[model samples]
Structure formats: C-alpha cells, structure tokens
Target chain A: MGETVIALAGNPNVGKSTVFNGLTGMKQHTGNWAGKTVANASGHFKSGKRSYTLVDIPGTYSLTAHSPEEEIARNFICFDKPDGVVVVCDATCLERNMNLVLQTLEITENVVVCINLMDEAKKKGIDINLALISERLGVPVVGTHARKKKSLAALVDAIDGLPHGKEVCRTDYPREIEEAVKIIEKKIPEDCEVSRRWLALRLLDGDLSFKSEIFEREGKALNHLQIRRAVSEAKMYLDKSGIPAENVGKIIASRLVEKAHEICDGAVTGETGYYKTDRRIDKIMTGRITAFPVMLLMLAAIFWLTVKGANYPSQLLSDFLFGLQDDLSGILTKLNAPSWLHDCIVFGVYRVLAWVISVMLPPMAIFFPLFTLLEDSGFLPRIAYNLDRPFSLCNACGKQALTMCMGFGCNAVGVTGCRIIDSPRERLLAVLTNSLVPCNGKFPTLILLISIFFAGSLFSSLTSALILTAVIVMGVLATFFATKLLSETLLKGKSSSFILELPPYRRPQLAKTLVRSVFDRTLFVLGRAAAVAAPAGLVIWLAANITVGGATLLQHCSDFLDPFAKLMGLDGVILTAFILGFPANEIVLPIILMAYGAMGTLPDLGSTAEIGTALAANGWTKATAVCVILFSLMHFPCSTTLITVKKETGSLKYTLVAAILPTLMGIIACVIAAEVMRVTGFC
Target chain B: MNEYISLNQIKKGEAVTAVRVSGSSSTVRRLTDMGLVENSIIECVGRSPTGDPAAYLISGAVIAIRSADAQNIKVRRRENG
Candidate 1:
C-alpha cells in the first residue's frame, strides 16, 4: 500500500549499481549493511506515481552461507521479505549467473530476472532466448542493457504485476534428492520462510545458519539439539546412499550445468574467434613470467601519467586561488577589517582551501579518470588476479588487493571496497590493514618530502616521482606483511575462497568515465577534506596565535611531543603537526608552514636549492628527512581512517589494535632508522 | 599415488572439494556469496601472478586460494574407474 519495496540482487560486476543509479539517480548512501560494514547501498525511485524503495543486496553467486555476503543476502531475501526481487544477471555469462537465479528461485517465487548487459552479450555474439529463460525459470525475464535503459519499462511492469502472479515452478533436482527433500520438508515448520525443499538440501549439506534460523523461528516447537540431530541424520542418510551430503549440492549444480550447456548448444551458436582472442590476451596478461613485470610497468605508467599530467593543472589552480586570495585580502584591508578577522578569513580559511584544491584536486581528477578507465576496460580485476598470491601469504583473501588498490584513491572508499572480501575475518583484516596503503591524502606529504629532500639537482622531478612510487610500494608491502602477521597471530584463520572473474576488456566510455570520476571521486575527496579542513584551519590559526606565556599554543604542543619525536628520528614540530592534522592529512604541511611563519601556503620551493635552504632553516638533517619519510609511510592512519576502522570492525578492541599496531610500527621503524643513522654517522 | 596423496594434502595441481569454510559468516558469505556453492568442482589452476598461493577455477570463475586456507580444505580424490 505504501512504497513498493523492490529488492535488487545480482552477481558481482553485473552493473546492478549502475541500474540502481539509473533508476534512483545519484541520491544514495553507500554504508555498511544493517549491522556489518559490508557496504549496503539503498536508494529510492518513483515510477508512475508508485514510489519504490530499491535495496541493492551484495552480489553473491549463490545462497550458500559460506561467506557473510551470502548470509546477509539469504537473510534479507528469506526474512526481511521484500515485495519483489530483481535478479540482475550478466547476459554474457548466463549459465554461471543462473546459479544465483536458481538458488533465488528455490527461496522465493516473486522474482524478476533482469538479464543485464545484453549489448555486451550481443557484441560477443551470444544470443540468449530471454523467453526460454523466463519459461524455464518460471518467472518474468527481462533482457536489459541497464546502461542504455533498454527494456526498463518491461522491468517496471513485471515488478508491478508481482503481487497477483501465479507461483513460478522451475525444475527440481533428481528424484532421490527430491524425495529426501520432501521428508525434510515435512520436518520443517510451516511458518519458516524458506522453501522446505531448499531447507532440506541445506540441512543435508550441514548448513548451520539455516538450521539455527529454523530453530530460532520455531522456538520450543523445535529444540536446537533436535534440529542438529535431524541435520546429522540427513547427512548420514545421504552418505550411506553413496552421495556425501556435501556433494549433493555439487551434483545438482553439475546437472544444472549440463542442462545449461544443452540449452546453449542449440539456443546460441557462435564462432570461436572471440574465445581465441580472450585466450591470446590471457596468455600475456595472466602469463607466469610476464604478469608481474607487466603489472608493475602498468602501475608505474599510471602514476607517471597522474604526476606528469597533473602538474600543470595543479599549478594553475594554485596560482588562481592564491591570486584571488591576494585580491580579497587587499579588499578586506581597504574595508578597515580587524587584523585577526582579516588573517582568519584570508590566511586561515582561504589558504587551507587553496592548498586542498591545488594539491589534492589535480591529482584526483587525473588519477580517478585513469583508474575508472582501467576499471571499465576490465583491467582492474586482472590487477587483483596478479596481486592475489602475495595477498594470500598474509592469510587474506586476494580481493583485499583490489581494496588496497582502491585505497590509493581514498581509504574510506577502500574500506568500503572490503565488500569484495567475503569472509568477515578476512574482510575485517583487509579493512584494518587497508590504511597501511597510503591514501591520496598522504600523497602530498610524501611528494613534498621526496621533492624537497631526496631529489638531487639533475632530473629532480623524475627522481621525486620515483621516490613517491617507492613509498607507495613500501606501504603496499607493509599492508601485506601486517595482514599476514595479524592473521597468523591475533586473528589466526584460513582466508576464504575468492573467485575473481576477469571480465572481457571493453572500450571505456571517455565521457562517462570523466563525469563519474569527477563527481564520485574528485568531488568526494574535496567535500570530505573541505569539511575537516575548515575547522582545522580555524584550530591551526588559533594554535599559532594563542600564546601560553611567551610561546604560542603550537609551540607548546610541539615542545610537549619533543622527547618522543626525538627518539623516533623526527622533530617535535613534525609530530605535533601530524597530531594536529589528524582530522585531515591535507593540512599537515599547512600546519607546519603556520608553525614556521610561512603564511601557511605552499612554501616557495622554486628550485631544489631553495627547498634545501628551507629545510636547513627548519633544522632538518638528511637523517631527519629519512625518518620523516619512514614515519609518514608507517604512521597511524588519519582520523577518517580510524573512524572507518571503528565502524567496520565494530569493536573497540579491534579498532585499538588497528590504531595501536600502526602507531607502534611507525615509532619502532622511526627509532630504528634514527639508530642506524646515528651508528653509521649519516646524521 | 604419492602425487595424488600429496595433491590431496595441499599443493598446486590438486583437486579439492570445499568441505567447509570455518571462518565468520562474512568470509563464508563471500565465497558462497559469490556463487562458489558447496560441491562445485574446484581445480587449482596455477600459482598467482606473484607465485605465492595458487589460483583455482571454480564454477566457471577463477578464485585465488592461499596455501594456509588450502591446507584446511579436505578433499576426497575422484576415483578413476
């Protein structure tokens, strides 16, 4: 009677979110699933005076409770009980995608199968008989190119007709399993939401979640111990019949595969030309010897392009903003504004915003578009495939590598990307360790230090860029090592199985990639950094000016942290600025500038010599520079990351570990660097 | 015979059944969540591009499985008749 609840379910990378966006526009909040941080995205749409709430369930392959996403998806479908469910499947990968459809069919009869990416499937010469699939599944099947908004009207019509439709009856498993299912069905309580046949098969497979949920729902009517006994009995019976309970589900799947193969054999006919091309590409991309080098070269090129291409725009933006600031300041002075008010407005707020825009925006605008191009071209998943092994050594799922890759853009997005890692333990491990991968926020610090201290006279910019790349590599290595250490010690467990599909490379739509990247990533970074930087600007202003005794608040804080900073091969000012810049890493350099009376703008490092002179004035030795690099590389994450960690792990203990682990590592690494420098007399 | 047994133990080129996933619902859901259903035939395809653990082809999808996780998975060899 109210808003129609339309549940959107799909296999990963089927462009379900694209459809949600197409329908609901950009008004969506990407947050943790109800209780977990596995990224539940929901939005609303109104079609023909009937408002609809679209819930995007995590893309899962099946309804097996082997991973958290599956469990959440299963619970939402079976319990939360939406008005209708739209199962979006990749038309190109129909057979594989149908596994989820088959599983969903067993659960609820109210389903609309939206075969997405029809255009891509057509490009591949794969012709799907949507009517046949619809008739076979016994549900309304709508073939759609979600990106093009094809057949959207039909999809809506199907959803509207869901309430009055007759129950769709699809084929069942072999008679033996069906017989066993019937027996188990009789045992199950009628009020249980899931189908008895599905429950029976699950029980035989030793699905504890299904059994637990049944017991919880049935209460005293079905004892927990009794349910366990019944499940055990089902397993034993299946085993004695020469079919292991575990193998039962697989047998059914293989049978379905055989049927699907038969259907495709006649329903679709295509040349092997495309398949050959796929093999040829896979040969080089996924090859044993060539893959790693190729991946590194690709990453290096990406970073090089980002840095080289961004330089002009970054300088242009900086010059423009600062030039405006000068004009505004002159206007304020002419208007007889008070000195403090003028300083706070011009030097404080305006300066900080300029730094964020100049330093953060250009790289983001360049990097995000490049990253999105790779993602759309289907190269990103290959990156995951390439990195999965190193990731596995750390007792983490390979998908964490993808999340870590996302971390390069922003850690919040990276943490959210942990949805790809299905295991809660592994996902948590990924989320907690993701901050070790330096985000864009930390890029300016790394870039500034490298440009100022490390790059020599000749090929200075090139050397600085290389140093930044090396720092990123170090951060990634640390993430892997930390994940491995944590998995082995504190969270000792097996990493869950992750099947990452390398989708076929498509031509990335330039316009769409640019628009989405600008809106989604560039603006997101600016908005978040601006929110934190505004108050941070005021705070830094107050700290620099507010004097305790003869020294300012900034001096007092630095002096307080001086002893610890000295031991860690850094000065008090660096540590104090890091602490103050916790809200946003974009302001750390500004805070440092404010401390040194440089008016909190990019210090005029016109030449390498000038940068050297500035460092000399700031009491930074070569050893101090090395320590700053290491500390920045290993330090505790910014406040945003800390809050994300708290939200994802949902335990003060894990959050503490996440924070303390990185902090301790940073201190220890810095101290070690200081000692090495002292002993070697590098200082 | 030893190759089969060792393969049964834990190594690349061995076939294994996903006996049970022993991690949290999040972990299990991720695997099963992605359609790696119980009883799906999983074959170790090759080592990762970095060559630590191995990758496997499961249910028409390629999944990377670490040695540590692989060791926990119990498999019964498909008898050659």
Candidate 2:
C-alpha cells in the first residue's frame, strides 16, 4: 500500500488540501518532514487496479526556500523522488501558482498539472485551454473542480496515466546566467537523476542549501572533479559578464516569473479584471469607514449565534450525561465495588468530565464551523490585512489578529495558530498573550457573573450581550498591553515582512465544512479538555472530600489564600477555584459552590439564578463579581494551552512566560480594581 | 531612475510599471518570485483601513504588503495605462 508514493504539491490557498482529501479520503497519516513543524500528510488510495500512496507536501510559493515551509517543500521534491508530482494550481489565478509548478517541472519531468477550482475560473469569465498548457509544459494537464467528486475522474486518470517525461520548457535565465549554465550543464553526473540543467542552474545560483541536502540524501557531496571544475568555470564566466554574484538569486527568480508570464499568455483568456465581484465586496470589507464596524458586527453576531444556539444542545447533553451517572453508580453497587472506589469514579472523575464536555462542546461545535466558514470564504485574511498596522505597533503583525480570533474559541488552538507568524519573537508574543481573550470555555462563567451583578434581570438581553462584548474588548486590550510589554522587555525585535494574499472569495462548501469542522476543531478541543478534566476532576474531588483537621482540604486551601485574594477584592474560595479550574474554566463556579458548602456535591448549577444565589450567600458583592470576571478573563491559560505552548515553542522558558504573563497582568488588574472600590466606597 | 517613486508612494487606484524592487535579499527574492519583477504592471487596488499596508494586483494575484516593504520597490506611471 505504501508503494508508488506520489507527491501532491501546490501553492497555499490553491485547494491542494481539497484534492488531497478527495483522493485519500480518511486514510491519511500526518507526520513531520525532516524535523520541521509544518504538517506533512500522506495517504494511500487505490486507482482502478493500482494502489498508490500520495504525500501532500507543504505548500510553497517557490522552490528556492526562504521559510522553513518552503525549505521542506523544496527538499522533498529535490530529494524524496516521489513517483510523480501533481502540481495543483488555482484555475482562476494560474500564473501565480506556476512558480512552484514550473520549479517542480524543472526538478523532474514526472509532473501532472492539476488545474483546480475550474468552477471559480468560469465564474470570472476565464477560460483555460488545457491542451495548449499540456502541450507547452509537455506534461499531462487536467482541469477539475476539486470539491465535486465526479469532476476528478480526469485528474485521477492522469495520475494513473503519466510516464511522459517529455522535454519541458526550461526556465530561461538572462544571457549571463544562461551562459553560466551552458558552461556546466554537460559536466553534470549522468547517474544523478535530477535534471542536469536544473542542477547547473542551482549551482550557479550559489545555492548552499542543495549541497547539504545532497549530503543528507545521498550520503555524499557532489565532489566529481569534472563537475567541480565546470562549476568554478561557470562562476568565472559569469563574473566576466559583469553580473554581480549577489544578484544571481534575484535574477534567477525574475527569469522564472518572466517564463511563467510567457506560458500563460493566450492559453488562459479573459483573466483581466477578473475579480470584479470580489473587489466590490472587499471594498466594503476593507473600506476605511466601514471596516472596523463591520468586523465588530460580524464578531458579535458569531458570538451571539454561538451563545443562543448552544443552549438547547448543552441542556440535552448534560441531562443525558448526568442521567448516566445514576446508572453508573447502580452498576458499581451491583458489582459490590468498594464505596470509596465508587465515589472516586462517580463523584470525582465522572462528574467533572461530564461538566466540562457539556459546557465546552455545544459552543465550540457552533463557533468553530462559523469561524471555518469565515476562513473558507476568505474574509479572515482581510481581518489580518486591516489590522496589520495596529499589530505592527505592538511589534507583531495582523496575523496575530487571526490567532486572537481563534483564542475566542480556545486558547490552545490560538496558540497553535501562532505558528503562521513567521518571526519567533512575534509567535512567542502571540502565544504568551492568547489567553487574555476569554475563550468559549470561560464565556459561561463570564456570562453568569454579568447576568447576576452587571446585567441583572432588570436589563434587557441586549444589555447583557453589550456587557459581554465589553468584557471581550477588555481582554483584547489586555492582550495588546501584554504584547507591547513583552516586546519592550522580553521579545524585542522589529516586525518581520508581513505579506498576505487575499484569495478570490468563493462560496464555502457547507456540507463538507460542517463535517470537517465538527471533527477537526470541535472534537479536537473537546478531547484536550477531557484529557485534563479527568485528572483535575479527581484532584478537586479529593480536595472537597478529604478533610484536613476539621474542615475539608478545599476549605483549608481557600482560607489560606483568603488574604491574598482579598487584595484583589475576591474571597479565598474564588481564588482557589481559579487555581483548580486551571484544567477547565467551566467547573470553576461549581468548585467554588462546593467549597462554600452551598451544595453537598458539584451541582451543575442549573441556571444563572442558582449560581447567583450560591455566590450571594457566599458574600460575593459587586466588587467580588467584577474581580472574578476579570480574573477569568486574564488568568493563566488552562493546562491544555500550556501543554500546547510547551509543544509548539519547544522551550520551557517561553511556556513559562506564556503561563505567567497573563496571570501576572490579571493579578495586577484585580488588585487595582479592588483598591479603587474600597477607597471610593463604591460598595 | 530618480523620476520613479517608491511603490508605497503611489495613490490607491494608480497603475505603475515596476522599474526595480530593492530590499533585503529575502524580501526582494520573494517579491520577484511572486511576479513583481522588472517591467511588471502593478496596480494599487485597495488600501487597508489604517493605510499602513495596501493590496496590489500583481499579475492577477491580489497581494497585501506593508508599506515598509513596499517602499523598497521603485515604479513609474504606466506608459500605456
């Protein structure tokens, strides 16, 4: 099944992933390539009578590597020697994607040009003459709508069809470089399978990367005496032509662009001013006057939908799960299991697990799909583009806007999304501040506080939403503050080059997106929550049940922390709850209620009124409520996010900063809020 | 050459032919690879809300680049536009 590995390669946003998924379906494994952090996915699928494994390489704009992503992409095609490469190109913008395609073609003639998104191209009144492109590239070219399964028949046939390593239209360099190539082309080793002329071009380009990559791939350097002499002679000849060696890389790239321009002329027609519809929409989207309001409205609408939509599903899920708790206890009793064992599994682990799942699932289920739709519709980049100036002021870029938006769903996902930020400085800053934005897990807690203290039942529902939006704004502001603070002190650097491509907007595929978002984002986050929920549940159960001296362990810990918590205008129980709630924010209120002796067990407090009653009985005034909300908004990210930071940054130092930065800010904020309330006698 | 202004200096909706792009090796190389080479017709399609970065239509791709980097590219008014 692993035989005949074919590489699926393309530029970013070209729907290469769609083609890969259609070919591989669910039978795929994502693994690291050459120790790089980018996803390297490969899958096995059968075509007619043949079974082939396809590896989807990292999407790169060019084969001459700059970033790690580009490096992985170039190294794979140059060294991995897959049976064939299918370069997926967006039909609407074929010329831009051709750099990678043409580069792949130069490396090896075993290529199939997959012109994807044919439907989008037609909508733009663009026509592609497939035969002309096929003839020009001397490779089998197939056009298809990657989303529709039936349209892929020709593509699959091409994958199964090609052994045609016909002569390719080589990327012609300027006279100086061409003369250099001629000096060395015939000296290339015949046994080496890479195109000889391409090898000569790379050597003349002074590509040091290929030498090391060759050493790793072939276990030796290209030390052929004749080849070495020819390489030097080519360099000597190039020097005689008065072309500076420093400009060789740029010259080679410019020549490749020119060649791609030459190939696209006439073969693709009616492409001028193609994105008229998208341009009109983008005007309002990025319009100076309308941009910020539209962004905020879109955000609030998504949050509103998530909160309202999750209500019914969350109730049903919790009811079903809590119902199973009784059956589980009964089974334990029937088995004559020890009383302690039954209580540990039932009250301790099972209860917390059920609580986190019910609270986290419904909202994420609604939120992630909506977020994915925004991303799929291509509006998310506009958010980055519009916000770039603000972020650059913080020594970051607008890409962090994307990560911050994801933080609204889950901080861990946001932390992971920071990988897209190219600079290590900005990435770390983004990761460290991601938790400042309240995630969906904390939304329930924040809403409960707002409902009880700020937006009491006297206020309309809109007031509560406005208050909640204000809280999110505070978190976003806190993120910027922390980011600026870190940039000035810890991660000081000028911002890197910020380049974003806003792809043509297309209708999002609703069905596939729903299924994929549900599985990939919803379940993935839920799974991480459950991982810590089980263990943290046991510890919280132990703290509540195991008595130290007279009171329970939970009570003693709360009493000890009461003085410090008082400085922040919160009681000890509130602070202790936050500490324990490091696993999942949803259970924080329940733990506080349990510690307050308001309920004998962790009651999934049925309503905001119920939770409010418990807090009011425990002496939670407006100051306390404000502090608690602020803390939840700014506290250390949950255990799940910390682990992700540790994995992503692979540095304990950065992960520690990620955990401590927001917590320190939260503590400072609460302390100030509490003192102001006391001094002003606002209570 | 002095007659040509930097790309970032162009007004939105203006079209220019790139004379050359000069920057750090990485930036210039990447720009060229994305088809911002010599003589390529570049059009400033839209400016971001804050006006620090602008979207340019280069060879049919809408690329958003910050003004800091765009300042490195030299361009002149398109003769044929």
Predicted structure with the largest DockQ when compared to the true one: 2
Off by over 4 Å in 2: A27-38, A179-200, A206-219, A223-236, A458-461, A584-587, A597-600, A681-683
How large is the interface RMSD of each prediction? 4.9, 1.4
Candidate 1, which segments miss by more than 4 Å at Cα?
A: A27-38, A151-153, A187-204, A213-265, A271-274, A330-337, A456-460, A493-499, A598-613, A678-683, B1-47, B50-81
Q: Write the per-residue lDDT of candidate 1 for residues A1-683, one digit (tens) a residue.
A: 87888888877677777677767775332211111224457788777748899888877666675556656777787767888899988776776777677777777788998988888778778787877767666789888887676557778777777863666755467766666666566777776666766767777655667667755765666545655666666667667778877666555654555554444455544431224455566667777888877776676677777766776777788778878987999999999999988988777777777777777887778877887776666666666777776676676777787788778888877876776565788888888888888888877667666766777552456677777777788888889888988998989996656556655556666787788878877898889998888778787887877778988887888899999899988888889888887787777766776677664333543333554677678888879988877877776777888788787778889888877787788888899989999999996
Model 2 C-alpha lDDT per residue in residues A1-683, reported as the tens digit of each score? 44787898887777877888888885221111111125567888888957888888777778877654566778788887888899989888888777777888888888999999898888778999999988888899999897887888888888887677578767777888888888888776567766677888877787777756654565443556777788788887877888877788888888788878778878999754537788898989999999989988887777667666776787788888988999999999999999887887888889878877876788789878887788778787888888899889998977788788778878887887676676678888888899999887887767657767887672344566677788888998898899889999999988877877777776787877788888977787778778877887788788888887988888898899999999999989889989988877777876777677532356655555666777788788888888888888988888889999999889999989988888889899999999999889876
In angstroms, the error of model 1 at A253 is: 5.1
Please give fnat for model 1.
Answer: 0.34
The number of the candidate with the highest TM-score is 2
State the weakest 10-residue window (summed lDDT) of model 1 chain B. Answer: B1-10
> What C-alpha RMSD separates each model from the true structure?
4.9, 3.4
